[model samples]
Target: MRVTDLTLGILTLLGGIAIYLSAMNFQAIPGQEYGAGTMPRAVAFVTGLTGLYMIVEAIMSGNRGIGFRFAEWTRSGAALARVATVLLLILGYILVSPIVGFVPTTIVVLVVAMLTLGTRLVPAVIVSVVATIVIQQSFGKLLLVPLPRSDFLSFLW
Candidate 1:
């Protein structure tokens, strides 16, 4: 766990740095308000600070457990399979969204992911469908963000 913490800390630090650098690309807005980069830069700074704290804590504790040994293919294979499944599901949604539309695509993706994560079929399907509708409505109506909707489901609009 210590080694895992250290690794994650290092990765977080690197990611924070990357985010900070990327945020530099956004130009600051004039006198009225904050620029697009402001929030991201702030988040990056905080993340980097937290990561540094984690590293310092790890070093001070001196608990060096067994680190990552890729010699064991079983764990690595399982991790890869999980990642691949998620990627495939996401890709499937992107490909099918235009045809079946956003709600259906999102429903299918969510259900598959929930099932893959070991949820029972009935509950998974129910939760997935409900959550998709809620999220879609929240974003489309409350947030006023236009979500893709099928022409067939135009009545909802």
Candidate 2:
């Protein structure tokens, strides 16, 4: 865990630096001072600071009995299988969404993902459908982002 933390901290620091440098390209306007870079810069600064703190803590605290342990191939294989299942479900969503439209596709994807992750059918279907509806409404209706509409469901919206 310590090794993982250290690696993640270093990666985050590098990522933050990259974000900050990239944000520098968005030059500020004179009257309207805040540029596209402003929010990114803030995020980068915070990320960098947190990463630095983690590194310092790791160094001073002396490992804290946490370290990396590579799993056996069998365990790793199972983990990979779970990841692959999730990926396939996501890919299925992308491929099917255009045909069935966003809501139905999302519901199907979510339910499938929940089942793949070991949730039971009834709960999975209910939670998946409700979550999909909430997310669709939030991003589409409330945020004014246009979601793909099916001919069948267009009237309902």
- List TM-scores for all candidates, in order: 0.50, 0.54
> For model 2, how does the per-residue alpha-carbon lDDT over 1-157 read when each residue is reduced to its tens digit?
1256666677778888999999998978777879788999999999998888777777677753345666565367767787888888778877888778888888888887888778999999999878977887788789977787776545435
Candidate 2 wrong stretches, greater than 4 Å:
1-3, 64-76, 99-157
- Candidate 1, residue 79: how far the Cα is off, in Å: 3.5
Q: How well is each residue in 95-130 modelled by candidate 1, as lDDT tens digits?
A: 888788778788889898888888999999999978
Candidate 1 stretches with Cα past 4 Å from truth are: 1-76, 151-155
Cα lDDT, all candidates: 0.79, 0.79
RMSD, every candidate, angstroms: 7.0, 6.3
Top model number, lDDT:
1
**Model 2, TM vs. native:** 0.54
Please list all clashing residue pairs in model 1, or write none if there are none.
none
